[model samples]
Target: MTDFDIPSFLKTLSQRAGVYRMFDADNHLLYVGKARNLKNRVSSYFRARGLNAKTVALVSAIHHIEVTITGSEVEALLLEQTLIKEHRPPFNILLKDDKSYPWLHLSDHEFPLLAYRRGRRGGTGGKFFGPYPNSGAVREALNQLQRLFLLRSCEDSYFQHRSRPCLQYEIRRCSAPCVGLVSREAYQRDIQHTEMFLNGQSQQLITVLQDEMLDASSRLEFERAGELRDRIETLRLVQEKQRVYGTDRNMDIWALVEFQGVTCIHRLVFRDGRLLNSKNYYPDNLAGEEDPLLLLGYISQFYLAGHAAEGLPAEIIADIDSDEMTIVLDALRQQFDRSILHSRGVRGEPRQWRAMAEENARVGAQTRISGHQESLRKLERVSQLLGLDKAPRRIECFDISHAGGEATYASCVVYSEQGIASQRYRRFRIRDVAAGDDYAALEQAVERHLIRMQEASDLPDLLLIDGGQGQVGRIQQVLERLSITTVHLWGISKGETRKTGWEFLWAAGARQPIIPDAHDDGFRLLQLVRDEAHRFAISGHRKERSRSRGQSDLENLKGIGPKRRRALLLHFGSLKNMRGAPREEFAKVPGVSQKLADQIFAQLHGEDRSV
Candidate 1:
């Protein structure tokens, strides 16, 4: 690790277009940027004027610098985006939830397969039609295409093993390629028609289908002609449905709205002149940057290869325009290898689309604000009923779950009035306590949780446990031994009938139970917290029980240790598969000896004897 002297590094920097990478003391990338004059841009951080707090922190953390010179500003821009995506630095304002966009894959096969794909490993030799804005839109397109083309959606494995036409063929959604019901040439023609439809050539596809239908009719191929006629009708319907967008323009429209430091962004994707999909995003950790700069950062990070699995359109419409627009456009154009029209404003449909996006952004922000306020209201009511110094901002609840005495587990769910605080939630695998002993398990879980939580401030203001006097009493003793006085404890006990809405609450050091009305907001909130804790605990217990059951079956075998057991499971994909495998398959596992394989096979196959 070389020590970076900022002033000396700036002096050595080239005064030409390039991209620069900054790393911290640990060699972790901190930021990536492109500039026409590399020296000027590199020096700006150390300029000692107009540097924001975030930039200053980034500069302070920098320990080393790397630069790659490019032939032009566009090339530098391209490199910068690539590096930013490859190493998503802490300082960059990245797009949220950009991965997992859907694509339409037309696989290369004897009969080409058409399906809605979420993610694919690079270069499967397929024609991928989109990075559609959402899965629903992709599904709708796939359904329409299936109805029109009758392409097979089955997997290669399923297709190979099929003995007869499946339900898809019966429903007329697939042409039954596996059963040879549809000829290769005919299926290929349908594939071509589908490709045209996806690529915005519906009118041309309709014309082609009509010609094919006429030719088939002349040759007295009534079945083939009728199929062609259906396809033409479907194509016409699709074309008519796209009339809302009103032009054959493919682009993306983006809008952003900021309120009280929180920002909401809406993205509208248009394909073949139709509003195909829309998505909303609310990115965190902006550090109070201006909206335009944030927008630029988002655009750069989003279109970069790390995030975008598919290429960008020739045009993009945005609600904000920044000085970085030229650089951003250059990067996109270079990567996509075509000129991009970045429309910031327009008069007609584009304006209407942008307006819709802006409205969505506003609605998204309002909804978030409403949720926060509702959380605060619930907290206020809780504080008043519980006689707290202030609203109980951090409330923690605990529950123990088990099936009989097996795989007992404890869960700690946290709430902070802003709804569930998932990050602070904790789960404990109950040890030391005997199974089915809820009281002992609860005690062990609370002690372990408190010991691990070092910070005094990290302790919850309110400790909620599921059970009556016994559970509450056990937790109180643990707190006393730890000498905790400020924190409060409460226990929820179900009434004699053991049902919802018939529950009593017990407070620490109070002999009488405090029962709030079922309709009371604070009481309802407590029920919610208790219910969430139970759900969390049950989920953990069930998973552990399942894993234990699997492990016990494998561990009991004489020749199988943990390592060999893992190797076998990994090879077969699961215990069920391994059980179903033939005796010869055991010898193929890496760690199993030939004799050991024979012993393992005998045991699994119920021919058990001495190893």
Candidate 2:
């Protein structure tokens, strides 16, 4: 490989608006950015005196630079964001959790259920009500609406399997839609009211509820009348509390704060004059750019990348102001093709909202810094306890999950000095392994994980096994076979009671276990990591199992598609009901041919007969 010829390359550089990419010696992208003047922007990195430490580091690693010219600066800006999201270079401001925004889905069915979803990947029909900021916000909104409307929230699979209502109906959160207690018409009425609430027609809904309550009372249905009256009163109380926020606007408030290099941005979301949900975003700014441009880049990337749940609310209140911001606003206006009204200047409630955002960001940063310090101290103690040369910066724990030897999954959870790096967590489906053979499953998972990390050249400092000396031995064998010596491996085994805080730690070739006190911070951290691995594995396994179970019974039969299965199930009510039925009955269902019906009958009912 040859070093980057900066002087020679700069000779032919153009001065047009475009996006530029910087690559290191291995042809790995190091950073990507947009430039109004490509020549000037690219040359600034090579300048001798003005670059910061991070920029200088980036420039030093550069082996090549690539530029893509665009028609205009706006196109260049959009292209820059797209590349950043796709490549995620080290020097760029990376947004963690770049997954699609969460939404509240109302299904279209006999008794529709309200569900929180992150993406539109499910094979079901539904109406989406949000691109909410985060999962927590979506769940909170769904829970609140379910409480008011008593609509079902269970998955269709669970609903289908339920012989009776589960705990949710007993708790009055669901009106037993899975069972026959709730009529389709009644559920539709509840859905309509829920839609009104989501659509910001709260007062109209209250009026409708009041009228229903009076009608029920006139009909001498006191129980029904009382329920409607309570709903009306609760909605009225909510309206009273929401009166402070005028019913004329929906907006998102952005506040950015930097504390000792730790930057936190707090976003407050409001809709229909009511506070909906808020979230704190902590971006990784490795290049260390600090200016109003930081806030601008964040907002631009958020909406342009489709991270904003509601996609540019009617109004946006940001904490920073600058002439440079107009560049982004105009780009946004051109991209979204709307009058993007923006202002840093605020009065009254909006000013308070911005202030609150700032305060939240400040507090969030302080807490994070404090928490990081405490984590370091805990790591220091762990270093001393383990007699290691230094504290481990990145630790990973592995676990295995299965139920009766089916759908086995091995999970690896990562914890860094900063905190739990959940985005780096991974799950591996264990295949071709014997039933309940956790030892082999774990060994296989560790082998795969180590090989990948080796190729990526990003091995963890410490490896934790969620088992005793036996698991540690298997993993050690994997490392020895792979010749990986830098990673420190240890095992944690549950006590005889198999409870938390009773864990025995085992190191490689160690005869005795190190059983630390429950209050030890390092030990507590291990417990947390182990628990997270267990949780991740179990959740992934359960989802896979549920998905497999949801497949049609006729899926394995010949000549049966989704439509055929639907028709068969609908006509027979269920596969069980068709057990003793003749092939002629199956052939009568739509989309079922006589020959195929005979085949299905033979496979499903162990009998074959001509239709």
Candidate 3:
């Protein structure tokens, strides 16, 4: 199927509302669109004079066109958005930003308090706040609320375990509810005030504080009056910093900008009748197609894809009103079963606000373009410095670790052009090696890794080892034994000062040290790979060593088999606890008979000791 074929498919579409998708020859979706009249809208794309050069190019490669009929325009819009998000259609306006928004969570306990939270899941009791643009804003708002209402911020664990009022009480940041320093009824009053502040009733809190301050002063309670005055002053300061952009209590202003074939969209969020924050995102690449219809398409997918929906506003303000807008708003209404307002401003400050959002989007797009270009340059340089056949697309590094020749382990880390390939990273516990023999450990790791690679038919473009000539030699031997001649291997040696730049590279069969070009991009790439390998190895080593330490006490149990020793360790959690346990407690452990328990107790406490 070719460009001409798309027009034929378009002709078959009905005049009714629905969603349409364009796919390239490779079956990858190129675009997704919602149309009020699918037949009329889709037919326009095939018209020679109607389509732009980019659309023509897109149409030329199109091998498939699929459509889904919906009950209403709104359903079509929602479907289009969801499809675009899931497939990330190349020609569709993408939301580009997918970061989880922060929320203020209030614990659901009897003494529920507000706290800042990221992502969806956390402990049970608490009310959550805004997926505020940043953590600082969340913290600032939390601090102000705490100071004004003197609510407890301590975790349940700390609250349950506390023996005294603690520092929060002394500092006046908390009412010490945990230790009964404040009665439950009084604490509940503070909690109610805090909730009021969160609900945007700050003025009421200020009034109450003012009355309390005056009463305290009148009753000759100067310290109490001073505290209330400080709290009132803090609340005022918070309000002073909160600049309101508009009177609209809840709305989102979306702006789209296109530059150098990249699209950046910015969302200015207003919560509780105040401008809260703005979120910016840059699309992958649009290939120079700039139009309001595209922006409208982006908005539908942006909101519908579950990026910034939790705090969805009552209305969405956009620069243009396309048929897609009706579809998007309809889908949102269906989702929440609440009427949502969608409008375009032709005059007044609303139009100005829309223009500002568009401008922000443009700036964001430009910034993203610059950042991408810079990253590309860096990656290219990294490829060159490593003296790679072509910059190594997939590099794997290995490291070995052992504690005094006990519990030897190795870890292999992988990196690709995109970034670290965490799924490919692997760990190995070295076997058939003497304790404390670094050379044997390295050989065992390389051989095991190569055997697995041979079986899987998965070989990395480059292999890196964490040590000097000795590690290099071991890897070389393993490769030679396996007859794997095609893979490139190198060993990195640390500098005399154990610093970064002092790295030495040893490649198989090379007499001279094959040092990476100091200023070359390949060198930087190698350094990153080397550092990552070292980090992976060290982390694996530490974990293995810790496990070995926990198992050391098992070595003292002469009569215990491997399975029984494992059972003991698993039941007790650690060797220290197992060693310190009384005979009666040992007897209670599963799989431990009375005789074994007695033997363990006598061994731990000495034979003369009584149970």
Question: Pick by lDDT: which candidate is best?
Answer: 2
Q: Is candidate 1 or candidate 2 better by lDDT?
A: 2
Candidate closer to the true structure by lDDT (higher is better), 1 or 3: 1
- Per-model clash counts, in order, read 0, 1, 23
Per-residue CA lDDT of model 3 for 297-385, tens digit only, reads: 67767767777744678888886755658888888888867677876744544554565466456545534433423335545664555
Candidate 2, residue 36: CA error in Å?
33
Stretches off by above 4 angstroms in model 2 are 1-372, 551-611
Q: Highest TM-score among the candidates is held by which one?
A: 1
How would you order the candidates by TM-score, starting with the best? 1, 2, 3
Candidate lDDT (C-alpha), each: 0.71, 0.71, 0.64
lDDT of 2 by residue, 182-216 (tens): 88898899999887776656756555666676688
lDDT of 1 at 46: 86
Point out the worst 10-residue segment of candidate 1 by lDDT.
Answer: 236-245
lDDT by residue for model 1 (417-506), tens: 555665578899998777688889999999988866635457778899898887898999999988888778889989988877789898
Candidate 1 versus the native: TM-score?
Answer: 0.38
